[model samples]
Target: MTKYYFLLFLFLLAGESFAQNNLDSLVQIRGFAIAAPRPDGLPDFIKFVNEELAPRKVNTLILRVDYNYRFESHPELRDSVTLSKKDVRKLVDACKKQGIAIIPQINLLGHQSWAEKTENLLKVYPDFDETPWVKMPAKGEYKWPNPDGLYCKSYCPLHPGVHKVVFELVDEIMEAFEAKAFHAGMDEVFYLGEDKCPRCAGRDKAVLFANEVQKIRDHLAMKNQELWIWGDRLIDGRTTGIGLWAASYNHTYPAIDLIPRDVIICDWQYTRDNQTAVYFAMKGLRVVTCSWNRPEIALQQVDSHVRSRDLSNKELKGRFYGLAHTVWSGPTPFLKGYYANTQDPKDGDKTPWNTFKVMFEKIGKLETGH
Candidate 1:
């Protein structure tokens, strides 16, 4: 009788293990990183989320506000058409109901301006510029991403005034949105530790990179928030193809081993670089795959992400946090083109934009399937 009871107990234990091995054990993060809505377009943007994104299970948003908030610390940084506190509050409330997490992003390191003559933070606070004396390219000569253009101005991370205001800006945004995670726009930092700056001259580029990441992470830790950053600059260009938008700062990836593992890396790959996710995950950092412009490629990459996590390996399991569809060009044009256009004229299939939108909608339906 004892032997029989032992055999039955083993059978029940095996059944329990089998049940745990199913798909539900896998984790998925469905997120969207979008541009901050203009004040006039706020209502339409909110309505679109209620009507579309919520139904589609887009549970997270990485909003690129880029000094678009009326800051209490420094009003000078606020753009002419910044989002009011009420607007941010309203967005937070709306996201809460949809089970979505909103992480507001401020361009911390790169993207001082989109174009050569564009004006922004670095242009306003000249002292913060890492290579302030570096002349702007002469009339479209050696434009951005050329490695010599030095298009995007990086603030001297060592400057005292830099963090004083940036931290205040971060504090205000996190408080406004009640965010648990904050995305620091730290990609494409080309002008780091330049010889021009008295403060940062001759400093190790990797140390500068790692120090800045830790500084941001420490600030977030004070509020019990997690730090999220673009994984492009962290990638080694030798093994991976660093694109135009994501420029490597002279191979500063050695900083990866220096920073904390809890920092969530949003590993965005528009091409076959989806394999890069494993590099981050293997290093013990949480990761999310990001895509934009190419829906088929996005879908394929995301599929690969899920499949990688579903494997039996201990390191691979539960590392891929989720998939994020980053619509860098705001939803207005995307929606307009999606509504007016069908598949590509040449290919006779839906445009990449439409294909991506449809995928989100399908996921929403699947989430609430009857």
Candidate 2:
């Protein structure tokens, strides 16, 4: 009888695992990220969760483990100031207790800078430097404000040694957090064929994108894990000259069919209500509608995402997934103050994070028109 009970226990555990996987089946999962640093130099993400998420039923969080600054994992010297292991563990534990899926983001190819004065990555990989279309002759440099004392010049994708270093970054995060899915950022692939780099000079942009994506996919596959990437360049077909450098601003990509359809595409529009969400759905890809965090920028993004979802239902027989809002740069003082003041609002633009929770719940209501 004891042996029979042990067999039953194993069977029950397997069923439980299966059921948990099914929980993500119907689509439309909500998520947030600690991308922007708050005024106190610490992201108030945990506070946001305690004060906002628990009440609203948000269950997924994406923490960007690597931002403008370099972590210890960098092959070159490490940044002394980095988030501690203890804090990361605390974050994971807190989210787990709330039943949230934590997906940490590590930029693989671009957005490497944290500060202009310091050399976090650009100094290490000088060959990857891009000649900006709008050059500053006086400064003899063309880089954006890397407010956090980090570097920005992206590592050259064609550089053989860079892969090993990037892989180390990804490995460190996966090992530390034990997250199931890794977000390998392949966004904003500018500097593709800067005159200085011979390896990329004449290569077709689409092929270049596919090549980099495949490298990431292969690396993740070896680790028995899956990868998610932003989906703009791929949508711009090869014929359209829609590489990351310019495609994003125009919201034009070739076609989705040519790229690996299995990958989840985050179709985002921040300025206006759009049908791109519906277009992505019709392409048979998993779509997550993204809204921006800027109070001025977020409402239109939120309305766009919500409207897109509704349109998808009517236009294509596509599966509706969920909502996500991206907060770019360190938490701007204006936005941060707005959120702090309005977090417990009786009215006004609830922070984009707040908007996401509300929009996500509305996805369920859409079916019944509640």
Candidate 3:
């Protein structure tokens, strides 16, 4: 009888493992991407997570924390309006109660500045700037195709002291959110391997980008955590004709093969149905299809995600992990618009709030078979 019971236990454990694997084959991450709320707006954001996100089954919440948190390790990098540890705990508790995984983001290699204003990292340590010669516009907004060819600034990946400061911020933010994954916003990196920079000059752009990704991934691996990044910089812009914004033009696309496969890529395309998720998946990386402000395209992305998972081989199906709706604005304005049903005549159906609703409603129906 004791031997019979032992055999039965083994049989049940095998069944459970198979069931879990079957479930994992489907869309595993129903995500919502938004900026971290200010300290004052924390309550409302928490309420939204409880009321809106929970009901729709948003399992993954990627909050763009950037420099918006009060860091004990580097208090100098804190933004003027930031979330305190107390504030972070409230948000974390709300998410934990709802079974939502929180992934905190800090823009690492790129997006260091917007228009004329420099971001906190470069402002604090100016020596890290990859293109120190490319100055921001003094008066009006920075224009594209400018003399400096600037879109957003990037820090030199080879800078000796850069990772120490950034990794400190990463560790602190991950600890505060109790996150299993860290989203390093390494997207739209236009300024890399510049000729003028001492360390990175004449070096291979793809290697520089890949090395940085590996470094971040290795750091997270120490704690058995994962690294997530935007997929734009990994596409061959010139060959694919996906253009510079959505893909890479600076020859960094080849880095796709060099980086660790465990890194999750958030492949975003707003205007049209760009089926680049397949590219990432085929390349042995798990990818989430990200959409912004286009409900039609967002719905298509949802269908694509489901279809890819359903049709692909077992090896590739799980790599097409899920879909995420990205909100480019802050939580306060977005939540206000979402609740009020606010729509501009000019935008029509092209709004992130509208896409958020449509995307999740479709996800809810798909998951339930309704």
Candidate 4:
């Protein structure tokens, strides 16, 4: 009996080791990101998920669900056209059947306003605006490099009432999607720690940024969900020469060291292969290279990500998570362009639909070991 038990133990140990090795060999994540479909468009979106995404082995879908859902917790914040619980369930069911992880995103802190219009949160609660002094321009009067230096508006991180409302929405949305991860869109945060704000006037921008990131991360951690954010705010624009849009010109880059290591960074670059993924990995954070509207650059990003994993040691290789193709347009328009196989005359080959097809095809080939 003793001899038989010893043999069984050895067999189990060998089986466990083999399973671990197999998992480690496979790509960690194959992801696609886009805006969530409107309620009327859910059927087509689900069909795309079942037919296109599943065949290509996309295991992760990040839907930008910012203010697009019917919120019970905060009814005032709901968009005119929104996803009901039933609509969210359809998406959830589709992704679950395909073995894809669905992560819902809300643009937090920054992206409170666009060109000349304010988004829901700040519109409903005017006191949350980080730069309330700089008024938004009229509909057609908005331009870059204006005297106000306005790009997108950010909510004051130090506002006491901010998180109370934000957290409620976060919880409601996460529950609706049944998501295990939440993407807080914290990219291109230009206004932080501005001198005019009553509460946040002279605070360190890096500390403020890190504090907000850590707060969100900690809140999610309680439920054991992960927090993902864009990597641009954590990168130094001046030193890297990647400039303000792709990286950060504000002093918040130091937040890279201050923020928790577990936060996943979506490092995005459009026109060129920035190689900033390596920097993130070196900083002891897992990073996914994100691309938009540039097929060539997207392809290069895939090659670079694969190579990074192949060449690095075990300690560093895992930090090079994978690549995510980002679509900036609405789901309906993107689907129309994708099915029609048409490119924007103005954008030509520099369209997100083109990049999406090319990048994912490469990813599919890689997954098959072809």
Give the per-residue Cα lDDT of candidate 3 at 152: 90
| Model 4 stretches with alpha carbons more than 4 Å out | 1-26
- For model 3 the local lDDT of residue 324 reads 90
Q: Write the per-residue lDDT of candidate 3 for residues 287-320, one digit (tens) a residue.
A: 9999889899999998898888888998998899
Residue-wise lDDT of candidate 4 within 1-370, one digit each (tens)?
9999999999989886765444335457778999999988999999999999988778899999999999999999999999999889889998999999999999999999999999999999999999999999999999999999899999999999999999999999999999999999999999999999999888999999999999999999999999999999998999999999988898999999999999999989888998999999999999989989989999999889888988899999999987888999788999998998887788787788889889988876764457
Q: lDDT tens string, model 1, 116-215?
A: 6534677678788787777566556655456556667788899988898888888888988898999997887877888878998888888899999999
Better of 1 and 2 by TM-score: 1
Q: How well does model 3 score by local distance difference test?
A: 0.92
Kindly indicate the candidate among 1 and 2 with the higher lDDT: 1
Model 1 RMSD, rounded to 1 decimal: 6.4
CA shift of 308, model 4, Å: 0.6
Full-model lDDT, candidate 1: 0.76
- Location of the lowest summed lDDT over 10 successive residues in candidate 1: 361-370
CA deviation > 4 Å runs, candidate 2: 1-27, 36-44, 67-72, 75-77, 113-119, 130-152, 235-258, 293-319, 331-335, 342-369
Task: Indicate the worst ten consecutive residues by lDDT in candidate 2.
Answer: 131-140
Cα deviation at 346, candidate 2, in Å, is 21
Clashing residue pairs found in predicted model 3: none
Off by over 4 Å in 1: 1-27, 137-147, 241-249, 312-315, 342-352, 358-370
Clash count for candidate 4 is 0
TM-score of candidate 3 against the unseen true structure = 0.93
Worst-scoring 10-residue span by lDDT in model 3? 18-27
Question: How much does candidate 1 score in TM-score?
Answer: 0.85
